[model samples]
Target: MTTFDLIIIGGGPAGYVGAIRAGQLGMKTAVIEKASMGGMCLNWGCIPSKAFIESAKLFKKVADAKSFGIDGIDKKALKFNWKKAAQRKDRIVMRLVKGVEYLMKKNGVEVINGEAKILDKEHVQVGETKYTCDKMLIATGSRPLRVEYKGIDQSKIMEIDGFFALEEKPECVLVDGGRINACEMALMLRYTGSKVTMVTESDSLIPFLDEEIRKFVMDKIKKAGITVYTKSEITKDAEDGVYVGDNFVECDVILNAKRRRAVLPEMGDLELEMNGHFLKINEYMQTSVPNVYAAGDVTKQFFAQVASAQARTAVNHMNDIKETLDYDKLPVNIYTDPEIAYVGFTEEQLKQKGIDYKVGKFPLSVNGKAMIEGETEGFVKVLSETKYGEVMGVHIVAADATDMIAEAVMAMRLESTVDELARVVHAHPTTSETFMEASYVAADRPVHI
Candidate 1:
């Protein structure tokens, strides 16, 4: 038996990242992954999706070339080579996957290619061979979910992997589900001139979004010419269209972009407590069984960054560091056209928690830089506790909102107050300056609106 100090199952962000950390701690670590080293986030999901988004944005931009002082362009007959973009997406995914492999080698973590079957908390079997470890981490991640709607043709369906694999654009697309992946696909394809419609089983699209942000996103979706139907299901199907609550919608493709379920490892009888679909973990990332830990999608921390953070925390605990990850301090981001990034409590969450909070907001329309960019369609909203001025949440809807959110995350992590945020010097004529401007509003002082 090949024995080691740590054996990580699943080489996604969580497993590979944790393996590197464990190697740094001088533990003999090996990672077992059935597929590519970087897992779905790199091979199929986040990286490829973003690549397509950038291309889609470029196509949209080219269509509005006259606004940029570039004339002699036909907007209706504008040409976009989607196959070239798809090729670029493949290249990007390959580059990142290889980079991760290099990192594993540099960190002295052995990369094993095989499915890990849990023999016990301390041993895992891959094929006919068994490997033993002093500590085990189950980071099996999740599989792309496949939902079969009633009266839907199976041939029209495409999952995330299939959507990215397409070299040509479809004429019309019906995106099933209402969560992150669905929203991303709908936007990415629609920007490339596909007639898109979003159908969800929920009451509203992205229901967890802050009410203001949700409204902003919905308005954008509508303006992009993508139709949405919430609380609707596919009832019957015809040759070309499916009935969505008495309305017939035609589509060349039906994207099954539902929320993926956690890929529970084959753990015969070695029981681990599960919370709904994800493996239950403690503050230290320890599973119910000692010396066994779980992280990433398997534990349902779907964000790639969060998965990596949780993985490091698990490794830290194994080395007696006693460090725990504070998920509350991390930003939850959605990559819409103008983007949506937020950290901490939403207004709804604050009200539900009964916390006394005050709000300060600055629209992009008032921002000098946003006006300069000609992409001024969002806002920066700040929330602070009334008594101590402690920052409760910061929400942004702008082009670079995802990047802007980390500052808010750091502020909350360091326990900074809204007054401090307002007092800080921000470079002029930048969207980030809105953070300070919004803080000024929260502090009862007016700046640039």
Candidate 2:
């Protein structure tokens, strides 16, 4: 048996990050991972998808390269090499995995490769070996929630994991879900020359997005020639394709893009309180059991950024540091063709909370940089308190909206008012100017609206 100061179960974003922080605080830490160190986000989910998105975006750009002053460029000469793209994605994933391994070594954190079974709050077993720690963090993460229906065969249906392993791109695909992944896959497949149809049980795609932004994205999706069925379900799985509701749509493949649930590892005789499938954690990410904490997808907020923050907060709480996470200022993003990002409360959320707020919006159509790049398709919207003009939320939908949201997140974090944000001069002919303009509108003195 071996003992340490902390033993983290699972080496994904949450587990590995927590291990590094614990080790840096002079606590001996060991991370137990059953598979690759970076887990789903690196190996299968985020990194690989972004790599594919970049390739698809380049293809789309080249199709319009002639308008970009490249007079002699032939759009017909362009062809996508899936094998090459796959290889590049794999290389990027491996390099990052190696970098994480290096960090683990540098921080004096041990990496163990095996499934961990928690014997108790402080004791865990991996195979025939036993280990003990002063505290345990169950960061086992989550798996895709499988849906079952009549005539549905689990062997035939392709989940995200199986979707990544697809060698040949389908001629027609039916993407099922209304979440970020579904929107991304639908756009990526459509841009990659596939006939894509999206079906969702929600009223619209990305139901969590701001109402206006969701409608704008839906319009874009329609303009892309991809069929969509909302407030529907796949009632039958036919031989040629699936029947979404009563409509039989012909497609070569069905991509299930449903929700995910916390994957609880084997914990013998240690009953932890659960909120559905997730292990409930407090503001500091401490579990119901003493000395046992949980973070990441295991606690409901299923983003890498949220997971990493929770991991750090858990470690800080363990070290007797009085620090907690604030989810209100947490930024969220979707990496579709026209990326979507937001920080702080949405207008709907503020209304529900009975907070009187004012809204200001600036369309990219009026921005000089957006016109130059031929990427003017969205807007930057700011929501602020009516009385104080304090920035409450910022929602963006544009090509670089994800990158631009960091400034908004900082403003919300510092409790900056719209007047302050408006007074700060932004450089000329930039997408960031749209944000400044929106702030001015929020402060009630509109400029270039």
User: Mind giving the per-residue lDDT tens digits that candidate 1 earns over 1-449?
Assistant: 99999999999899999999999999999999998988888888888888989888878878777887888998878777889998999899889999999999999999989888998888899999999999999888887675766667878878766677776888898988888778878898888878999999887778888898888777888888999998997777777868888999998888877778799779976899989878999998899998999999988889999999999999999999998777778889887888889999899999999999999999999889988877798999999999999999999999889999989999999988989999999998799999999999999996876
Question: Which candidate leads the pack in lDDT?
Answer: 2
Tell how far residue 3 is off in model 1, in angstroms: 0.6
| Candidate 2 lDDT by residue in tens digits, 1-449 | 79998999888899899999998899999999999999878888888999988899998998998888888777778777777878888899999999999999999999999999989888999999999999999898888897775686555568876576677677788888888999898999899889999999999898888889889889989899999999999898787787888899888777889898899889897899999979987888888897999989989878898888899999999999968888989999899978899999888999999999999999999999999989998999999999999999999998999899999999999999999999999999899999999999999899885
- Per-prediction TM-score to the true structure, in the order listed: 0.97, 0.98
Q: Kindly report which residue pairs in candidate 2 clash with one another.
A: none
Residue 349 displacement (Å), model 2 = 1.6
